[model samples]
Target: MAAVTWSRARCWCPSLLQVFRLPVAKLYLGRPTMRASQQDFENAMNQVKLLKKDPGNEVKLRLYALYKQATEGPCNMPKPGVFDFVNKAKWDAWNALGSLPKETARQNYVDLVSSLSSSSEASSQGKRGADEKAQESKGILVTSEDGITKITFNRPTKKNAITFQMYQDIILALKNASTDNTVIAVFTGTGDYYCSGNDLTNFTSATGGIEEAASKGAVVLREFVNSFIDFPKPLVAVVNGPAVGISVTLLGLFDAVYASDRATFHTPFSHLGQSPEACSSYTFPKMMGSAKAAEMLLFGKKLTAREAWAQGLVTEVFPESTFETEVWTRLKTYAKLPPNAMRISKELIRKNEKEKLHAVNAEECTTLQAQWLSEECINAIMSFVSRKPKL
Candidate 1:
């Protein structure tokens, strides 16, 4: 197996700086020289797996560098090529640590993790008194009932536009569901949109230049799609309304996609000067003929629910009035199936194509990172952001 890159581990540290309200520079400069017990370091490593929020790219890079120095003593690997922006950035981050002693690096890593854990606990405690409704309204709402784990997009007001935090949340939700007692996992959104896809704010709010932003975004995206590709149980999508961009593209990975009559599927990658993601590049062409896939992905053709069903992108279309009732009724039956049998069957079906999907995901993300830094993509995103938001 290949060594896991920092990008693969990027999902581990969530909301460290934000929870503590600390500047990235200050966090590092103020690091205490106090030694931490090896047991403490091991415990911190375990705590990292439980983190559920994104702490920003700079913080992620710092954590990666410190972890590398602590474990491997130094960055001895050869630098990646320039076009391999994700690995290149990670390599540079680890290499920049110079000759820091392993013990000091371990102590620093432990301290950083401790601070993040403390701040997260403090923030949660503070929010415990806030309105429960408000808390539930933001981010993801994951519920497991009747052996079905339902992950809903709770940000209806924004048309379920996925922020960085939401992406991490969804990944965590799926991770938990995969090992749980659920027979199936479902995804849906609230309000008028199923999902409008990646929030442009994820790009705009990044502190570094486009290169850095694109690199980090690529890392997140690769892991996000991998969650779907590696999902063990039956994965279903209940398309309540309009779905665009990544949301539309990713439906190709779902075991079943039930759409409301009012739902629309669109992947306007070309308009944004981007390419297909979520393994759509391969899955679309495989499901629908190459011509139809090119029409939707390259020509930006939006499909109605019926049209999507006709093209095999959607399994079925339901009347808007009964969409939820009808879909869940069927899903409840699906949830009652023998869990082990279902998982084994799913694995057998996906096994042959799993390697292919992973390859395509990696390729798409790499291409997207380069596109994101291109003048064409930059101008397109700027123009779109400047205009009124629409689905």
Candidate 2:
């Protein structure tokens, strides 16, 4: 009789509670193993249900969700205070806690806990879609306006450097926009900077690994760029200042490129001890001729927007005051055209560029993923993060 009772308890107990040996152990208020005071747990669950109507706070949901995961029993478990909860667990030791026996229920609880925590944290961010929508419509925005979307790189505070989550947001936004016919043309950057380039601060946490920080940005950045280049609608770029690193190369692929006379461009490939990105190696030369393109890529020369225009890279240079209105008028003109007409013509021009961009992005991801995990990249990032200005 004693052996049979012990075996039943072993099969029923949750791993978190199995360590406890009855009498002295503390008990949580919510659990499946109870009878006389089970209504307490039911009351707690009911309270949680009421809170659901006001999910604006979300605290109750988070607590209930955690409790549900911590226990391996029917969600309609009993509530026991610390002393009484322990007594209930010991009392119900011989009974299976959930419908799927015990082990299966425990596994579900563990998995549910992990997922709910992550999701609840993400939810705390609150209506991310709405934030993006507001950004797209206001201040200065990047747009093909219809079927083509734009993500303006704002934040001159950090020299227009992008944050890591910002990178992820752009990627996800572009992906979401890709499916919508309302988006076709995509542009980037705003204010006085085209992009002071990737916010170097995010390099350390890059998903591909560490040593390859530069490569990861170049690789991830290329994906962000190609969404537009290969887009069925024309991609336009309006530059105002240094189009550094990835920014410098991406512009070469734009269907239309405009810059302010104050706009400048450079690629710090050599400064970072990295190689060139995109097919900037191939397309830059093809677009601007070998001699001129090499001058910019090889030297990382800081070319003024007017200089880039002269070299056949930029389409035109506009004054700062009029640049926004001029680009908007141009883009909206295209947006108003028969959508299919614009897409078909765009397809013909980008067909070959699409193939090249694909191959480059794959190779780039591999090369950069390796570099992100390297020591030099680690120190470079840490130093940059810690450094105060050398007065």
Candidate 3:
């Protein structure tokens, strides 16, 4: 359970944050400095059982001891009188595995326990207010005398849902315009949505299935985010209607994101039974707390423009009626700036934010890739692809 702890140890988040808990037994066995993620630990756990299977034997027992020593401090600092039956059972079971070097394992366990500091324990139940899905979208297009470069995902037919070709087009257009001295600033997204990100069906099929596609998507989106993270010139995105999943996540990497009043926002990954990509792991939590970010990432809930604004995650929102006009007007502001200044500013800001962004992208990729290879994730993808579209 390197990347994650056991679900049992994990706080069951009916809503909001689910605390991450580790089973006291064998918790300390892995390299603590490294976040093994849930699947990493599970894979190793399974392997241990396979190769070192002794029911109530030494491998399992040593694992248990390691877990106890590692988590000893985190579990409310191990009270002498509060020792419970579960601990006793784990101890008994652990005893079956011969004790090796307790001190050496202790350090590793402590490291594993420290990793959970990044995990939040708060829940919606304890909060004073509650809200569900909220979202917004707008179109950012610039068609002035300078140069014409429009990026629109506002295809009304599919609610502006993106196709694979659309992403390729975006990359191509951005790269081209950014490189072309003739073009000053690039316009992005249009209509009800700048984009709704990937077409899940096409994505699933193209990658052969969700499990296979997830890893691939993670890698691709990481690169995609990097492209926008620091384009030479200014970029203005018009987000209209609802922008969910990768659409919302990627927007965070943009310099300026504008949306309509009715433009809702969300990362629908969890609802879709998927993990987040597009470097959201670091961005989300850094902008929002672990609890808030986890709510979006773990639950796939949508949020309103006002809600996003409050969190400072969104810059501005316009009414639906004037969304298009507002988007262009807002973009014109950036277009008005000295093109060279805008370019340098974008680059400078990105350099400042680079480390954390890369760290998050790296973490998201690691877990996403590992999860893609799991039976649970693979099975889920098969089931999803086999199902008919909802009416």
Candidate 2 residue-wise lDDT, 254-362, digit = tens: 7788787777888765444455666677678888898888777776677888888888788998887797788777766766766545554665466546657767766
| Backbone clashes under 3 angstroms, per model | 3, 19, 40
Best by lDDT: 1
Candidate 1 residue pairs that clash: 14-53, 15-54, 15-55
The model with the greatest TM-score is 1
Give the Å shift of residue 11 in candidate 3: 68
TM-score of 1: 0.67
Cα lDDT of model 1 by residue, 216-292, tens digit: 99999998998899887899999999999999999999999999999999999999999999999999999999999
lDDT on C-alpha atoms for all candidate structures: 0.78, 0.54, 0.53
What's each prediction's TM-score? Answer: 0.67, 0.57, 0.57
lDDT (tens digit, per residue) of candidate 3 on 1-391: 1222234222321111111221222222332344444444444434332321121222233455555433342233333333453444344333422343444455543443333222133322211121111001222222234443555564666656665555555555555455344334443454545556566665456647655566666666665666665455656556666776778887667666777777777776654556887777777887888888888888866788878777767788788888778667656555556554555456556655765676777777777777766676666656755783331
Question: In candidate 3, how many clashes are counted?
Answer: 40
**Model 1 weakest 10-residue run by lDDT:** 18-27
Q: Which model is ahead, 1 or 3, in terms of TM-score?
A: 1
The worst-scoring run of ten residues by lDDT in candidate 3 lies at 127-136
Candidate order, lDDT descending: 1, 2, 3
